[model samples]
Target: MNQLEALKRWTTVVADTGDFQQMEQFRPQDATTNPSLILKAVQKPEYAPLLQQVVAQGKGAEISALMDQLIVRFGCEILTKVPGRVSTEVDARLSFDAAATVARAQRIVALYRAQGVDTASRVLIKVAATWEGIQAAGQLEREGIHTNLTLLFSRCQAIACGDAGVQLISPFVGRIYDWYKKQAGAGWDEAAMAGDNDPGVQSVRSIFDYYKHFGIRTEVMGASFRNVGQILALAGCDLLTIAPDLLAQLQAASGDVPHKLNAAAAQGMALERVHYDEAGFRFALNADAMATEKLAEGIRAFVADAVKLEQLMQAAAV
Candidate 1:
């Protein structure tokens, strides 16, 4: 079997893209989208019509409303191709505002519901893994709105999301790799940290082991992978949201994709459960320079793309 097929034996493969047309070939169980992906998709020739359609449908509505509508439109298209769920991210600008995050998530869910999609089962509101975002996710979870906590970069972030009883947490793999590699620079040994030893892969492994050790019910989905090796390392993660490029690589490659992670192995490993209250969570996140820098950078990047998306919508409205 190809690596992609081998992966399906141990993991639920999720296509991480806003390009719904590209998702059908891989046949991923779920799909994820962020402002960056959506912005990229809307600019594509095939997806330009989708943006124009949402703009046309919401003529005089607020730009933000139309933005939400566009997200749902892409999500609705994705839902038809995937059997599981579609993670629609909340605006990154509201990442630190608990109330605003909750409100936006609710509105996004409502938009999905209005499109006749089963919001409860098929939609996951993607929120950044900030303290406020986690708190907001907890609130949404209580109301039966499932959330996927994204931008997660640390064990503390994962623990807090688990505590929030979120449906899933997306621990970014590639971004962590990028930060460490840039820091190491000339000192970095590519071969030494190639696969399971990779910092990014290790980050997800640590989070996965901790979650399994504590019996945390929140699913762990490794995200933002830079290569197929990282995905292979976390072969038994609850889910892995792979970009279309990486998914294609996996589909074409034939190999024995071993189960590198499993609850049974994780439970037996030596790991301690860490609890993080709000203040503790903040301090923990603050102490990790890599996580702090990357989290802030990730939010800023998303916010910038969101603005660019708005510009595109504005032009389309005219």
Candidate 2:
């Protein structure tokens, strides 16, 4: 079996793309999407009609209604290709507002439900990993809504997500590496390519170990990968959400994909579970340069995509 197949033995591989057309080949058990991905997908020629069609179908509807319809349309299509859940994000512009985030998340889930998508268990409402976001997720979870915490970077973020009893948390590996690499300049080395040495993998491992150590039920999904090496390093992660292109790379390789991260091994490790209040979460996140930088960057990028989506909606409103 190729590494992709091998990795599946120990990890739940999730396709991390907005393009549902690309998911059938990798056969990820689950799929994830963000505003960035939806923006990218609607720009493609093959997917442009999805944009036009959704807008056209909603011609007489409100812009907000049309936007929600378009997002669920993508999620609805993606659900047909993958056997597992599809993550549809809430508006990042509401990341700081707990009640607004919760309302948007409910709206998104309600949209999916209206399509008869069986969203109750198969949908993951993606939210930014802000304190407000986490609190919103907690409330949603009580209402039988599962959440995938996005834009996560710091360990405090992970702890908060788990404490809130979120269904899952996606700790972005590549984005974390990007901040430190740019900040470190020539200090970043390529030789430390796998295992604990990989910044992204290490971040996931840290989160994973903490969760497993405390028997936290929330899942850890490693996201925003820079390469297959980072994915391989987290071979036994709870889940690794990869773009279609990286999934293809893993499918082509025949390396011995050993289980690098095991829960039993993690439980035996020295790392203890941490409990972070709002102040502690902020202080810890502020202290971590990479986490602070990437969290801001992730939110800005999502806001930009949200704006582009609005423009698309406005043009269609005409």
TM-score of each: 0.99, 0.96
Query: Candidate 2 lDDT (Cα, whole model)?
Result: 0.89
- Candidate 1: RMSD over Cα atoms? 0.8
Q: Model 1 TM-score?
A: 0.99
Regions of candidate 2 where Cα sits further than 4 Å from its true position: 193-195
- Which ten contiguous residues of candidate 1 have the minimum total lDDT? 265-274
Clashing pairs in 1: none
Q: Report the C-alpha lDDT of model 2 over 31-56, residue by residue, as the tens digit.
A: 99988899889888999778888888
lDDT per residue for candidate 1 within 101-153, as digits (tens), equals 99999999988887888888999999999999999999999999999999999
